[model samples]
Target: MSYETYAELKQLVLPHLQPIGTNYREAISGEQKLVLTLRCLATGSSFASMTVPFHMSNTSIARHVLATCEVLWKVLQPTEMPIPNEDKWKSLAKRFGDLWDYPFAIGSLDGKHVALVNPMNSESLFYNYKGYPSIVLLALSDADSCFTLVDCGQYGRVSDAGVFQASRISQLLDQERLIIPDESFMVSTTEKRIPFQVVGDEAFPLKKNLMKPYAARTLDTIKRIYNYRHCRARRPVECTFGILAKKFEIFQRPMRLQPDRAITVTNACTILHNFIRRRDGHMIDRTSEINYEIRPNNEQGLMNLRPQQGGRNSDEATEIRDLIAAFFNDPRGSVMWQDQNVFRNVLLLED
Candidate 1:
């Protein structure tokens, strides 16, 4: 929020966070706190660096950043995502490479570990390939790369499958309830209406609502095109992750704070990112002020593989090689997949 914008927001929300402190130091004020946090997020500077510019103590800055994030996170996280219904899953199958549309139409489920400095206890649990200990943030990103669902705080040792199993979404899938709204329909003898489903890597199981891509088969064109198109759309969450890790810089390195608090801050940043993106950063293109994680080298995307799974030999290179081949084959790839809706709804247009 800018200077005037901050003033306006304070007035509108004034009735809400009245300061218990007689002075600014006593209790966290409202807008000032928000302003400080935004500044920290945008600048990605150290607390020591921010203390002078924001005119607050290091401890105070940390408190406000955490407190403001807590409040905003509750308001930002989507309790329910839009589009698709229980009855419509089959109907929408044509839209996703002839695959049955389940609960989530074009969601891509994946886990990313944000590098953090090793903590004191430094359990082996948090260490990942980057050679640093960090927490795991598993998310379900739509084709547009927007994170429709997110789960954080798991130690890095937990795999994507493990994170999903422990998530509320996993529970819903197990119960046969989809995340769609009240208006959607459910069929068969059962009265329960399962909403949409989600897409994931090979690590996840295929139930009523979750779908995973085959890791092998570079020669198969259909699955290859399917994977390519989905990834083109799904890269947004990666883009979002890139922005958070880079601009916030704190995330690029091992976070020294308590793991739980670090998770909170991370989630808070994600929510705020979506909020900002919703306002102005909606497209996964260049509109964002921060974009890290350099583009994959086409000459090397396939041959170059990011090693994972405890230093065991990885076949991701071959899979990625197939992906590049599939990408060039798709007409939709020409559009650059700026919005995920393009892929989710692409099959609809052709049909």
Candidate 2:
């Protein structure tokens, strides 16, 4: 973060972080507290590791870090990650169409596992399929690679679909309380209107407003094109995760704090991510840290290889998927380079 950005953030949270001085000794200033918290987040240093440098005891460092993190979330979340209204959702959809060429996509969804030390007496509840104790950080990111919404601290054992099912956004979606825009026609197509949706990987169920790629083995050229376009549109969330992990080194290793505190730390990092992005502009160069290749062998046999964990898809969802696939193959909705990209290896196969 730049000095200007840090100064602005410090000003916003200073009121909440200020400490009262006593006759015995001067209290730590808010500036010092903020610096201590940022150092821990940026370096993932243990509280004990911070003690000698800050000239404070480990307990004092931990207390101040936790307190400052809580304040950062409280102060920053309202502005940095505000709840999206219907107009905001529409704006996001427009951005996706313009940038990624996927119409009516309001956001891209994914889950990231933050490693954790097992909480006492919790058994294997936190242990995940990857053989680590973790907490899931499920996020919805906009086309600009900024997080629009996030749910932190889910047990790592649950699948991405399971975590989404239990999320508050899922409840809002079910109750029709979220202000998502109504169904609208796709660009260059007048056949039928489709609901605004979020794109995710196979772990998510196909819902009226959520899309996953079709099963890999069953895909033909048209479906492969759909998956290709779908993955392109979904790349921002992956990029956002990469940027977050790179910027906040705390995520590189398992957090030593308890589950609740770990959640606080995660939330703080996400809020700060938005804060920095808004100030520093989008990090377009960092997208290369993640692979963008869509190899034919991998696309045909390996991607979406895992059996989708969520239950049966509704007929409406199936129709939506088919309609999208058809659109991608049609002249009106097709891209110029898609055919060449999808079939670039055909001669090798023929040989």
Candidate 3:
């Protein structure tokens, strides 16, 4: 982060992080606390390692880092990452249509596994299929690679679909309280209107407002086109994850703190990611060379769950997918290079 950005953040959280001094000794300044926390997050160093440079004991460093992380989340979340309402949802959908050529997409959704030291007595509760303890970081990101909503600290044992199913957004969606814009035609010429939607990978269940690509084994030209375009639209969230991991090296290794503190630290990192982006403008040039698809060793099995059994998608959802696929295949909606791009891959796969 730039000095100007850091100063701005320090000002925002200073009131909450400020400490009271006693007659016995002077309290640590909020600026110092913020610096300490940022250093820890940036390097992923152990609290003991921070003591030599910061001139504090290991316990004091840990306490300040945790407290500052909590304060950062409390202060930054409202301003940096507010929940999107109807108009905001529409704005996101418009960006997706304009930038990615996928009409009516509000966001791209995904899950990431943050490695953690096993909590005492938790047994397999925190243990995931990847053979380690972790907490899930489920996120929904916008077209500009900014997080729109996040649910942290889910048990790693859960699948991406399960984590999403249990999120507050899912509850609001099910209860019809999410305030999505009304359905509209994909283009002026299309007869059927479709609901605004979020795109995810195959681990997610298909719904009227949530789309996943067609089964890879069953791909034809049109389905392949739809999948290709859908992947394009869905790339933002993946990019955001890559940028987050790159910015906060804390996520590069298993966090040594307990689950709750780890969650707080994760939350703080996400808020800061948006705060920095909003201040620094789009990071496309810096992030373009990043391999967004790379996963940490702990996250290799994040979405390995089999497709949900015995649960059929509603016909309406199927119809929406088909309509969108047809739209992509139609000249009015098709991009010129999509056929060339998809067919080359098809030929390679056949070989």
What are the lDDT figures for the candidates, one per model? 0.54, 0.83, 0.83
lDDT, candidate 3, 185-287, per-residue tens: 4343345555678899999889878899999899988899999999999999999999999999999999998999899999999999999987885643211
Which sections of candidate 3 miss by over 4 Å? 186-189, 283-310, 348-351
Query: Ten residues in a row with the worst lDDT in model 2?
Result: 286-295
Residue 6 in model 2: shift from native, Å?
A: 1.2
The 10 consecutive residues of candidate 1 with the worst lDDT sum are 288-297
Give the count of colliding residue pairs in each prediction.
13, 0, 0
lDDT of 1 by residue, 104-217 (tens): 244556778865667668668787655678788887654444456677877777777787778766775565465342232222322232224455666765443454554654
lDDT of 2: 0.83
Taking all chains together, the TM-score of candidate 2 against the true structure is 0.90
